[model samples]
Target: MSPSELMPIGVFARRCGLTSSALRFYADSGLLPPAEVDPVSGYRFYGAEQLTRATALRQLREIAMPLPGVEAVLAAEAGEASRLVDAHVAKIVGDASAALRKAADVMSSLGGAPALPIAALKGPVLADAVEQVLTATAHDPSLPVLGALRVEADLEAVTLTATDRYRLSTRTLVPSAPPGRTWAGTVSGDDLRTAACHIRRSALVRLEAGPHGIWFRTTGREDRYARLLTEEFPDHRLVLDSLGTVTGRATVSKEPFLRALEEQPGERVELRLSGRAVEVRPAGGRHPGIALPATTTGAPLRVRFELTTLHPAVSTAIGPDVMLDLRGHDQPVTIRSADRGDLTTLAMPVNPSHGPRR
Candidate 1:
């Protein structure tokens, strides 16, 4: 055959039926670079060699392998490349299976029928209530809810919580949870994790609490039943405070907090409460305290929050404002949420009780 025509980016996009944006993305990702770029104009040009790579990349992406992963496969040695491709194929198969399972459940719900494995839940309406609370309440995997529930509506709401000692779970039937009187539940401290495992296929999910467990059931399956747990659960509320009472809301620079702890672990980050601003100063004031550039509203209470407890939560805080509610001295500070549900209500003892006594 005669030599194939060398294609430019525009020609490659047209022939491949892809978009210019996609071509640029591939080029930037190290998967395919243009043959040349006009020095002054900076216009990208492509050669035929890249077409092969582009075609293969499109196929790999179709198989659900991400761009970075594709690069790994391409760069890997012969034997290693084979193993990587095998792993990629296995992931694709597993992902497809999961997708099918979800589709089937959706169809079943749409048909107004109970999803399969309905027998997995067998208990009482009380179980449904526990499922509601344990499902709604903030959860920490370090603490899990070992309970079940039954419902009697097309929707319900539940709160789930655990205390290494006991678990408390409750549900609300305000037309939010499942229609039936029963469902299973789990608890976790991670939202991304909760979405993956729990909260599968259903509408109206208010992540008012921590993520831990999940309950899967068909929509409009009201006659459903649930198993019950007749055990006492520790009162997390008593151990914790309400979210509204949180008056302290300060915006601190996250970078310095990391540096302070790195300089000296176990040292407290002193937060001096004045009017509406709390200066986050390092212990002993060796490193000058950094006044939060932002604003806040709360009681003028001077407190020292542990760097260990504060750092991790602040690092993972959803947005700019790290709202801290320190109402009770010994109570855990409530980490305010500006999103769907409460992000974290961390129980922190009053910082002053353990004074700076070295």
Candidate 2:
């Protein structure tokens, strides 16, 4: 193409709703490079076709996707691109919720007395257990305690619990030694995740808690610490008991089920379970549906759920097959790993009148 066909950086930036400097920065970061560069004047130019990539870059950056993630999305195919963007949005929302809860706890402790010393627990097993329940930690600011991982240890095992009011997860691990006395407290979800990440680098991880703060350390590495959220965790055992008897049950392969859901177009989908197969389609529509084989043993049922809320829980399920424990359309749906009883996720269905659950 001739010089007339190539758009100057300034013109291209204006057309793409971006600043000239931003285009330059994106080019330097390899997110959106210029189509051409003048050897003498250092002027940059872009072809008309480059606008699609430029627009995508701007939109991805606006959503706070990291440069590396943006590059991955830009390199992906159409289907993969949507999946990457969805995952990024979910992470940002989760982090924002945790931050709000942490800020609230900090503000409330301004004039409180010093905290008591917390006992120390060391081992990768404990760290793994804490990480498991962190997935269910509450991200909503309204319920600050649920934003924390409840840590309880006795002589035999360490238990971790987290809930977001909508769902709950509990994990237990056998500890190397039992504390002489029980040690229980709530720690920020963000802090627990950081600890879990660091613990993986060492053979043994040590956890120490005090009235003012909590600390996690691995030999030859920098220790991590944060203020513990003193709020009381709800009686989660009672919540678990209230899950009610399962009225319907189905065990389906995770990969196929997840793929079908991903291919579905909308943010909500209706799940219809028949004798031995489940049909998934866009909520309130008949076309664009897929059926997958399942081991079902209950009455045929139809339920609608927000895909955003249901997808993550299934994506993180432990094994090849996930078991669904259903009560009714209006009730919360319980999902578990068919192989292990340790992991459980509960997702509340979308109320018919209110549309999708936020």
Off by over 4 Å in 1: 1-179, 182-233, 240-267, 338-341, 353-358
TM-score of each: 0.39, 0.63
Per-residue lDDT tens digits of candidate 1, residues 99-195? 6446544544665533322122222332333322333234444433322221223234333343322222222334333444444333322322223
The TM-score between candidate 1 and the true structure equals 0.39
Q: RMSD for each model, in Å, please?
A: 15.5, 9.2
The residue-by-residue lDDT of candidate 2 on 123-207, one tens digit each, is 5656666666676766777778878888776766667788876567776665445544568878888766755766676666555
lDDT of 1 at 299: 62
- Minimal lDDT window, size 10, model 2: 114-123
lDDT of residue 268 for candidate 1: 71
lDDT of model 2 at position 235 = 89
